[model samples]
Target: MRSFYGVVACLLLLQALLGANARAETDTAAAPPAEVLTLHEAQRRAIEGYPSLKAVGERVLQAGARVRQARSAWLPQVEASWTGSHTDLSDVDVESARRGARSALAASGATAGLPSTSVTGSIIRLRNLAGGAAALGGIPESVDSYRVSLGASYLLFNGFGRKHTTAVAKYGDRETRAARDEATRLLLQAVAQSYHAVQLFRERIRIAEADIAFNARLLKEAKLRNEAGAASLSEVLNFEVRSRAAEAALNNARNDYANARTALSVLMNMEDGTLPENVEVETLGVETEEQMSLPDGEAALQTAMASRPDLMRSQWAVKRAGATVGQRRAALYPSVAAFASRDASQGGNSRFGEDDFSTTVGLNVSYDIFTGGRNRAQIAEAKHAQKEAEYQEDEAALGVVSDVRQAVEDLSTAQKQLVLQRDNARYVEKNRDLVAQEYAAGQTSLALLNQSQRDLVEAEGNLALARVSLLAAWHTLRTATGETVKDWPLD
Candidate 1:
């Protein structure tokens, strides 16, 4: 029997263990996979997952809840409650009081009249009955009580304060929503900037790599010419130095690229500032002419005024402040409300059913007759706030216009500069090619070849920077106008 019991226990334990392992495997399988995201995906995730934006989203929800709370004033409120208590009602000596009253009445009466015995006897009997009833009524030491009640009050009128409060909350909610949108836009812009920065560094590194290759080729030619007794030792040494410098520059560019990538990953809130290997950015491709066209400054400014979330938020804030002023002014007027209640109770140290129920319904009106000038001060404060909000809205609009204009100007300048830099790069490339051919033919000095190569590298780097600058300017213009990249090929 012991062996059989042990076998049963071991089987049960094994089954439990198997179930636990199965659950663990299931949970592991259910876990979400790691993300591989594009630029758009990064922006989406940032807006949805970033702590700052989530906080702002919480504010928006709170504001919306406040609006509902303010609007709830018009709805009826109902509640129900039950109460039980023990009360002492033995303070009064009812039996003694009744006997004293009977004695006094008999003394004052004219008992000397005929039939005094009978009348006195009847009065004595009546007094005895009353005392007995009083004694019985006072027999209980304490009274057990129970009460159940339900009540509701509706704000029929509150000098329109309820309406004004609701309006204020609604406007505040709108302001928060606009603020959140603005925050999202800014976050997207930050991601774009960081992502573009990474691309910029990557391009620069490529340019550095190209320069390294060119220098390596030159160094090899110089070494070969010197071995053949055609090149001077000084030329060979200069080529060696140039090659080393190019390698160093390449290393620096690579480091900068890594840093830029890390920054982008951080902005996107990726795990450990690391992006998935499969993710490919769209804007890292070669630039095209269509992607570089500058929008009209006037049009951009117009768009900014209409679409900028901050400006819209400011506008709503002004309205919210105006509603607050209304709410404050409402304090000067009276408010009327309707109320209703029902109560049921039982007492006398008895059962629960031995009780009576009562109902009450009424309308209440209230007005702050004297507030020591508090209401006036609040009204004044609200008005000042309204004025300040209005001023801020106007100021924000002006700032938007200025930003749009400046961004347009900067973008135009960058575009023109990019053209000039590209032309210079082409010329430098041609000169470097000529110098390379002459050096190989033993006709040109190594110093001239080195100078040409250096010039070409500088020009190429400048051209790459100019392209990045133009792109950044375009992004700035779009951001200032509350727009995004549209009709522009990112890659």
Candidate 2:
């Protein structure tokens, strides 16, 4: 009997432990997911995935290609030419020269007024072919004398066209990079703003949820009071209506959160719910008050103008356009290049005998006297484009100024509104509590009690919105000021 009691006790203890373990797990699983994300994380992800950076990378590659093209102008350009002519030109010397090469080679150095090579027959042929056309393998009727020549030319000078063109290419790369940075700034700002909006709506939903729970409690109290003949049926019905409105508000808030999260994922190029799942909008990190510091207005504006990537891009664009003007103007000047050529030829006077050889070297110069005013028209177009770019740069500066001023104003206003809204919410919450106590003691009407609760919930919701607005405004100001990293303004 004693052993039987011990076994029963052991079984009961085991059952109790299992029940406690199950309850713990059930409670844990039933709790809501944790929330932890900050506006900065959203901005960071946006910059990493922004597409404009791709275009800038392409621009860098293009610039490198141009650099290679420009440098190639400095390298010797090699060319080859071969002639098989049966033409009966009045000036026979052209063909005669080709024939000369074959004759010079077959007749040996003696024909070209050079020493014989019986002692150096192999060496003699080298000297003969080196003599030129006839020695190379040409003839008087050199129709069969093949002439092979390697010619080269290099630009000795141009109105600094290649030099300036290279500079322009490099600057074009810089400009593209700046444009990409500007794109990044805009994207980051947008991400920050949108995420802030999501947080705002979520907090509104929280407020609404709290209001709904309170209303449900009020509703239960009203129903109980009506049953006890202390409250009217209409009071319970009115509380139910309030609860329904709160539910609707919570549903709308949830939809807004989902939309905002979807947008963020797309911007970051992430899985639709992956980033959002990892991010908890409710527990966003904020910069401490001690970390926050305000910038001087004039100084900030100046820094914005100096540091804004858009402005720098515009400035470089002006330079690029100016370089184009120089490039076009350069076309008017005559090109001066130095060239040299060496060749070999071999052919028979008839068809199979070597009687061909020749040698010659001379300077060749060329210039385009006219081209239907094409160069003039091109220069005129370039000047106009340069002017356009210059004006565009000026306009870009003005736009920057406007953006900076507006962001500053928005940040200032939102900060004030946030403070006021927070104060208003606190006061209304206290008023609601006081009214609830008075209503229970029969010192306040049901209508007054209901009105106080509604006002307090509205105040809380508005306060949440104000907080979001303030955060967005802070981001806008910092972005406009060209500040990528700064102490957070709201704690």
CA lDDT, every model vs. true structure: 0.80, 0.75
lDDT of 1 by residue, 286-341 (tens): 66877677777787888888888899999999999999999999999999989999
Worst 10 residues of 2 by lDDT: 348-357
RMSD of each candidate relative to the true structure: 14.1, 10.0
Candidate 2 to truth, TM: 0.75
Off by over 4 Å in 1: 1-38, 87-142, 277-280, 283-289, 348-355, 485-491
Q: For residues 82-124, could you state the per-residue lDDT of candidate 2 as single tens digits?
A: 6654544345776666566656556664554655557576675
Q: TM-score for each prediction?
A: 0.80, 0.75
Off by over 4 Å in 2: 1-35, 78-150, 273-278, 282-294, 345-364, 485-491
Clashes of each: 0, 34
